[model samples]
Target: MNSAEVLSSDLDLVRRSLLVQKSEILNKHMEFKNLQHSSAKATDEADAVVQDLQDNLNIQLHERDQFSLLLIDKALSKFADGTYGLCECCADVIDVRRLKARPLATLCIACMEDQEAPGKHLFQ
Candidate 1:
């Protein structure tokens, strides 16, 4: 395929992925909000602990979704700058499979592994 076609295909993939994730996040948020409202009406002391745990889990999920949204936004911005699919750390083209799996990935696998290595920051 031509470069323009390839770019259009990749952009469509990333956009679709982001839209799906955002839809999921919004649905979860609404569910959690409903749960919170329902729980507020509960008077049973035994259920308090369970509710607390559920609330904590919901908060964690929301935080994770927010971070994912940020990554998606950054990826979209990179697309606008004609830099999408290029590793942020090494300027190498990230593998198409990896990009398909993680649409917002900024680093190639090797660079990601290096960043994730134990004591990597200590050496730097």
Candidate 2:
């Protein structure tokens, strides 16, 4: 088909991928919550230390999953507003390959590189 059709198809794919990721994250989060609630109390000092470390790791994982969900939601919102695949900084269309690789990416490669450059200032 034409360019518009191709872009639309790509966006649809990205949207589907994002939704799948969101669902997976939600399911994992639920499982984590259940596991946390059902965890047995430590009976010894060594067990307590191990449990504390495990709890810390679980919290970090939960936070990471939360952040991923937020990014996925933001990307889905962009799709709703007809702005998916557009760079947030330069307003240029982001490469479909990049989007396919990182569905939550909001910047084109050039803008991303610029932002990551040393001594670069980011406003807001």
Report the number of the highest-lDDT candidate: 2
Predicted structure 1, TM vs. truth: 0.79
Candidate 2: where is the Cα deviation over 4 Å? 120-124
Please list the residue runs of candidate 1 whose C-alpha ends up more than 4 Å from where it truly belongs after superposition.
119-124
lDDT of each: 0.83, 0.90
- C-alpha displacement of 16 in model 2, angstroms? 0.7
lDDT tens readout by residue for model 2, 1-124: 9998998898899899899999999999898888778777667999889888999999999999989989999999999999988999999999999999989999999999998887777544
- lDDT score for residue 13 of model 1: 88
Candidate 2, position 84, lDDT: 88
